[model samples]
Target: MSASSLKLRMMIVTALFAAIIGVLAQVTIPLPLVPITGQTLAIGLAATILGWRYGTLSILLYLALGAIGVPVFAQMSAGVGILFGPTGGYLFSFIPTALCIGLYLEKTSFNLKNAIIANIIGMFISLLLGTVWLKYIAELSWGAAFASGVAPFLIVGLIKAVLAAWIGIMVRQRLASANLLYA
Candidate 1:
């Protein structure tokens, strides 16, 4: 298929979203085991807007930027070494989480309900990776990891998922009306 000029726009928006994600992710609420932040919300929004390939690239870019000590990450630190930290799971998980959200929307309409379902599923993917990393990297037990890494964020996760879905639908509507999408 031919490339769309929208790629350029997507790149700009992706960068903006990455920065937003990084900034929003700063307010980490420490849990009994892991910490929670609004990073997933940014991931969801980026995926919905950028689609799979660019969305994944955007997250990877964010990670790479952080790795270079750009302070573009949640905790304002950077480098591959930070991957061993407590919140590392969520950071790594963002790539695949974004892929899932973007890929799903590529084939289907992104309604609020569908976006919610997609974001929930994507978040589950993120939580699974994050929790596993918490257990391994953080040297926590599985039970404890689940309790801390996943449990406390459940309610807020749901809320973020809903918000992501709603935001996706709204953006889609706006794009369609403005003829920003393929006409």
Candidate 2:
């Protein structure tokens, strides 16, 4: 493919992933402070499959859609308020989460092991950042933040990480084999 066509393909894929993130955001198990949503899983998948550049682009696109009131955020929430709300830290953290996950795979290899490691790291990053945000925004004590934000999500996050790694590697391999993804 020509450079232009490749760029177009990447853009299309990025947009598609953004939409996927939005769709997955609705898969929520509600909680008091922040619900457990499939957003992180989608983030992991994007990073593992798309690498740093496109993965981060997809996250940025997703954020932009939500900021514009597209109702793409968790529980179909949207607008700039959500970006600045109590759960906003998690949303903001997705950028670095995706970047780190994708970069790790790009630096090492896009395999299930590396993807799992990367996603686990991404999970911690999100938890840490989101907890801090929740603490201040929600006026909760650090203990409360840890209890609600970090503690509850650990096991679930690990499960999602593994799933993302497994599924992402499979899909990535297929895409590469089909000449749909560049190395």
Candidate 3:
């Protein structure tokens, strides 16, 4: 495809990823400690596949949609008030996460094991930021914040990262076959 067409494809992919995450937020795991959402998978895969700019744009678009009260946040909640919730840690960290994942995946040579490791690290960065944010905003200490925000998501995050890496590998293979990737 032409350069302009590729850019258009990236734009469409970004918008679609944002919408996918918005939808995923509605289907929650509903943990007693802190609710878990499928958004992590969407964010991870979006970053891993789209690269930095598109990944960041996808997250920004999701934020914009939620800000407009699209019921895109977890449990069908949205608007500015969503920031006041304890889960806002995870919510707000979505932006940094995409950039981190994009940078890591884009820079590193991706093998199955390495990609999974990188995926976990990237997800952990988001979870760490989220847990820290939860600490101050939720008035909990580091331990308590981790319990509430980070702990509950650990297993799910691992599982999601595995899936994201799997999808990413598949996409990479497809793109490679089409001779559409840079390296």
Candidate 4:
């Protein structure tokens, strides 16, 4: 592909992932603790398919859209305030999380075990960053932050990571076969 074509492909893929993440964020399952959202699954999908550079850019693009008064965040919330709010760390962490997952998958073959490992690492990074941010921003103790921000979502996050990995791998293979792997 030409340089312009590659750039266009990147733009399209980034926008597509941003939209996917936005749509997934709306599919929330209310829980007594932290509610489950599909954002992480979408993140995994984006990272695995797009690789580190484009994957992280996609997440950044999504955040930018949300920051620009687009209701793309969970519960349809938006604005720059959300980026600096108590939950902001979780949102910000999405960038690094996608980068880590994408980098790992790009270096290694996209197998189930590798995908699971990458997703788990990325998930932990997000939770850790989110917990720390919650602790500091919310004036909560470390234990409280971990309890509210990390502990509640551990199991579900793992499930989502695994599922996203599987689906991402399948979708990537299909795209590759169809000569539409966004190259």
Q: Candidate 3: which pairs clash?
A: none
Task: Give TM per candidate.
Answer: 0.88, 0.98, 0.89, 0.93
lDDT of 3 by residue, 1-183 (tens): 687876776677679889989898888888764678888888877777776678889999998888888988888889877765667777778888888777877787655665687678878987998888778877898888878888778898999999987887677667656655433
Best by TM-score: 2
Output the better candidate (2/4) by TM-score: 2
Whole-model Cα lDDT per candidate?
0.78, 0.94, 0.79, 0.87
Superposition error at 150 for model 2 (Å): 0.7
Tens-digit per-residue lDDT, 1-183, candidate 2: 788887788788889999999999999999988999999999999999999999999999999999998999998899999999999999999999999999999999998889999999999999999999999999999999999999989999999999999999999899878767776
- Model 4 lDDT tens row, 8-102: 86678779999999999999987543467889899999998787888898999999999999999988989998888788988999999999998
Taking all chains together, the TM-score of candidate 3 against the true structure is 0.89
Cα shift from native, residue 110, model 4 (Å): 2.0
Residue 181 error, candidate 4, Å: 1.8
Selected candidate, larger lDDT, 1 vs 2? 2
Worst lDDT run of 10 residues, candidate 4, spans 174-183
Off by over 4 Å in 2: none
Instruction: Between candidates 1 and 3, name the one with more favorable lDDT.
Output: 3
